[model samples]
Target: MDTYITNKIMAVITTASNVSPGGAPVFKCQSKDDLYSITANLEAILDGIAHALNDEIYIIVKH
Candidate 1:
């Protein structure tokens, strides 16, 4: 099982623009069971951060 999570972090890096670079999302898991647990935790964290930010978060599953 493979899990992917992408979340936008910063909005701007320098005075160039407010367009922040895409954050390299990550997940931690060993097997199917661990995958589920890790994905769940990541979802919760992303949920909280997304609530007060203009960023996008997504999850993808591949077998």
Candidate 2:
């Protein structure tokens, strides 16, 4: 099987102000891919959920 990788961020979802030990949300996963790929990844990442996964999701491009 072939794999596609283009710099990704390891994301985590939480449901509390302070995530204690053994209480951290699962790692969702983020990326620094192209616009189309980024949107598609975000869409799939946030699918079927009715709550804000995190405080914010951002990226910084160094160029």
Candidate 3:
């Protein structure tokens, strides 16, 4: 697992949970910068989200 990729995923989860009501039990990624950084390694980010949430989650990667 790449540290850069991990950090990006963490950023996504943090941002999404903070914006959503009740902090829904789902993973989300909506940062264009972050998305662009991990465009070539999306699978790693997605995998990180799944592992971090420990449940099925949604990912919204902005181009």
Candidate 4:
């Protein structure tokens, strides 16, 4: 079987100001619409899945 990345976080999208920088890229959006839009685009571009941790946070992950 071919090996591939699994259960890895590709990016972080959030509107919260307190979300400090860390592992994976973080995208801060001004509005909910922008957040959702960026998250969707990142998901598609990264070939990952978008999982909303909350109303203001979204994480793109690969599995």
Candidate 5:
């Protein structure tokens, strides 16, 4: 899923940059640390999705 999502994001960003004026467009991060922060947030979102999918709610409630 990460691969799918990251690839899609990259494709979109790449396309935008190519057609963008002066080759500058989208994803404005001030520094590498900011980029890392964004990645950490993305990982947390993916982790939440995984946990939600793997959750067994009804089974636990029945007991």
Candidate 6:
């Protein structure tokens, strides 16, 4: 058996303005569609996994 742990956040994509900019880079999108589009692109470009925290927020994490 094998196991792995992922805890690093590479980036953030969100449609909400209230989200605070933490240690990772934050990308603000104008709409839900834009958020999804950018998140997907970043996931591929950054070689990370996209995790939907909610309808308006997504965090890219490296595995």
lDDT per residue for candidate 6 within 1-63, as digits (tens), equals 897546789999999999989899999999888998999999999889999998988999988
Which residue pairs clash in candidate 1?
none
The local distance difference test score of model 5 is 0.29
Q: For residues 14-62, write the lDDT of model 1, one tens digit per residue.
A: 2223333454444333354554454455545545232212222224322
Which ranking of candidates, highest TM-score first? Answer: 4, 6, 1, 5, 2, 3
Best by lDDT: 4
> What's model 5's TM-score?
0.32
Greater TM-score among 2 and 3 belongs to: 2
Comparing 1 with 4 on TM-score, the higher-scoring candidate is 4
Clashing pairs in model 6, backbone N/Cα/C closer than 3 A? none
> What is the per-residue lDDT of model 5 for residues 1-63, given as tens digits with 9 covering 90 to 100?
353332222210111223342322233344546544544454454442211111111000000
Clashes of 5: 0
TM-score winner: 4
| Model 3, position 55: C-alpha lDDT score | 24
Cα lDDT computed for each candidate against the true fold? 0.37, 0.36, 0.39, 0.93, 0.29, 0.92
Give the 10-residue window scoring lowest on summed lDDT in candidate 2.
54-63
- RMSDs, each prediction? 14.8, 12.1, 9.9, 1.4, 15.8, 3.9
- The better-scoring model by lDDT among 3 and 6 is 6
Candidate 4 regions off by >4 Å?
1-3
lDDT of 3: 0.39
Question: What would you estimate as the lDDT of candidate 2?
Answer: 0.36
Q: In terms of lDDT, which candidate is stronger, 2 or 6?
A: 6
For model 4 the local lDDT of residue 51 reads 98
Summarize candidate 4's per-residue lDDT along 1-63 as a digit string, tens digits: 999887999999999998976988899999999998999899999999999899988999998
